[model samples]
Target: MRQHEAVINVMEEHGGYATLGFLNQEVLKVKDCVWKTKTPFASIRRIVQDERFFFKIKPGLWALKSYKEKLPTDILPTKEISKSQKEEFNHTYYQGLLVEIGNLKKFQTFVPNQDKNRLYLGKKLSDITTISDIYKFSYDHIVRMTQTIDVTWFNERNMLASLFEIEHSTPMYNSLLKFIELQDFYTDFRIVADDARKKEFQSKLSLEAFKPIIKRVGFWSYNAVAELHSKTSELISIESKLRL
Candidate 1:
């Protein structure tokens, strides 16, 4: 079997579409296809760009061209759906990526209660999150505020390590102001949104009110977040084999 053929087979088994991280993890297991290169992951990345056989669904996500029409509605929302519904799916998809990435990095993950029921791929966000309640590492008021964050990663000490807010179509101000509330903490903040909105994010972060966190906060485009997620999994897989 060919390399791209193996990737296609794996994607087909996954119902037509799969994340770059998923392909990197599963494509290597195909016994018939021998990946002789030192950078098989890179090869997979290049293969997905063939375009003749696959199509990109989103950042870090691709689907077999043959099965595009058969993918789940959530994976490829149609024009018949409301704009809000499409936005909702995109938001949760990134949240799911963050949750999985945090878990792989040995951090406890969380999402707001209202998002707990949203589907990330086929699984519920609540089902995949590591914690049901935010750690009461601070005052009641502070903890309550943290619970409403889009996605949060808590370190082993139960301290906030990072907070990510997906700004698909929402204002960056809301997420930035929310981050401001937790500015005292030694945590990193990111506004995850489209590359087109990067200027908007920077402009919002420049406001006098956000100056306190200007150094601690950064803008992450959707593609960047997706790339981090896919690469993180690759590194973990390497670590497993390199452990002494």
Candidate 2:
């Protein structure tokens, strides 16, 4: 690719926030795109203007911003969410929360389950632009919990209680499974290699295996997710805590 295209690709990868220094280094390293021949800084600006590749946050720093193709406006709630709606909502919301934490941790370090949508934090973490973008993405995901769980179905006044009862085990397991799937681990492999093992595991399991896992997972995951939200509530928080 040409210098401009190369820079655009990097910005695309890093959510439109590639530094000039980093771009210069990577482009120079590429054998085809000779450092002496191509004007990287100019190409970066050109791509930003032409392809809407990205814009400046500080002086020379640029990040990816995919604001064009909007996410779906209509939110889908869970099925049969009325009577046990609080439990369901808590599950979904905390799932998102765990996801956000996982995403941040992945950004900071290597996480095994980086691909799963723990709580719809992919959109929030990917291609961040301004501080407002960070807030908006987080806010959007948090609100989506209500849409999925149907807060009105469970509690008239105590929203917290309604959100606090969702079992976390299933969602956490789901998140881990999602990560494995992203890594191209086949489900059929589980059926072949671990099917009998799973059956035996299930058979040997106690009733607590089901309810206790969910309850503890729910509680812990909620703490994990809620902490992330609280930590990243402001731009200062984003900069200081999230390192965004």
Candidate 3:
């Protein structure tokens, strides 16, 4: 195959992302093609310069325009970009999609880490009710929920029900506080959970407090996924313990 085709094949094999150095090493083996021809380093750069090919990711690497992007919105129409803007938009759109997908995937992968922790506790909310239950549930939920895949899925009803179940036995304020701690404003259910409580609890904790926990869970799960960076784009801090 030609030099460019070989490079494209490498990008295709690695999920549309690759380092330039890695691509260069692969191109050296072609028999008829020189180390410079079959896998010519400049050819990769040349291919990217063309409009038909776009850089879908970076610091990671690139892919073809046909690759599916896991962005919140679909790619804008090609016509949306002026002739000159097509290349720019392609880069812009690719970066946007990468960030969006990275964020969601970070959140998605977070759940399994907590899953292991919750599984260890042996007392998931589905299995409990009453004040004491709430107390235990809160502790478990706080640690586990931080790694929850879908924060938006929780509601005040469920949160309250979980609380009621916990309340039946114990009155651990810390657990209730932890429950309130896991919420985020972006999701509807979280908003309800935030609103269900008295103003004191609602107003006390800042949004930033909740984020680090969620991000840590996200990072933990992300670490499990691969060598790629975690969802939070940072390493997970091991400061908090998941006590049952």
Candidate 4:
């Protein structure tokens, strides 16, 4: 109890909110501490659950409270996230990756006439309600509607380099329709989603109508997108160093 108290005091002194690993390290550093045989993290968890000093924001993530401070009533596990909240989180997360991919494409000089205009977000079908309206629209409007890919990387001549659609619990049918409508030879089409949705994606793509383009489409999980984002930074750093 004394040892756990000492750790809590240290945490409070440090302004609270630290990982269990960090607290365990601190406890191990104590000189000839009592209850050394027992695991510090287990003891700390018991103390927190008993006294309620903090809330687990996520696995290995926590938000601590001071003595007499009230615990927040709203903290919930990721699995408990509301439907709309989960959708928003997934949208924002995938949008960030799209932005990253767009920015990275801007740095590519190998592609002739590469410019900022090459990247675009596909217009939602809500912009145009009917197929009849497509006839009255100008060439640019038709192109944008036809190529309504979620994220696109094209060249100065408007040739597509890559395409991506973030399907966060939404039907893949619409995204696939847009991809097929604007199918370009030599362009890469990728569908990004949660890891658990790979089977769902395959089932959707296996439909007879989508057979022609199914072979060209690729699946990218959220974790894969995050990893790509991380590597993009490393590539940019290396490029900067090379230019120096």
Q: Against the true structure, whose lDDT is highest? A: 1
Instruction: Report the CA-based lDDT of candidate 2 relative to the real structure.
Output: 0.34
Please identify model 4 stretches exceeding 4 Å from their true place: 1-82, 107-142, 146-148
Residue pairs with clashing backbones, model 1 = none
Cα lDDT tens digits, model 3, 60-127, are 24456656463211233233456544443333322222222333333211112222222111223222
Please give the TM-score that candidate 2 achieves against the real structure.
0.24
Please, what are the lDDT tens digits per residue for candidate 2 over residues 1-244?
Answer: 6766666666565444544434544444455554353344455445655535555433234455563233221112334345454343334443443333333333211111222222222343122211111111124544343333211111122122112223322333333232222222111111101122343333322244344232222223333334344343322333543455
Clashing pairs in 4: none
Q: Sort every candidate by lDDT, greatest first.
A: 1, 4, 3, 2
Give the runs in model 3 whose Cα sits over 4 Å from its true position.
Answer: 11-46, 52-61, 65-139, 149-244
Candidate 4: 10-residue stretch with minimal lDDT: 107-116
Better of 1 and 4 by lDDT: 1
Q: Could you arrange the candidates by TM-score from highest to lowest?
A: 1, 4, 3, 2
lDDT of 3: 0.34
Q: Please state the error at residue 93 of candidate 1 in Å.
A: 0.9
Candidate that beats the other on TM-score, 2 or 3, i.e. the better one: 3
- Which lDDT values do the candidates have, in the order given? 0.91, 0.34, 0.34, 0.55
- Model 3 root mean square deviation, Cα atoms: 16.3
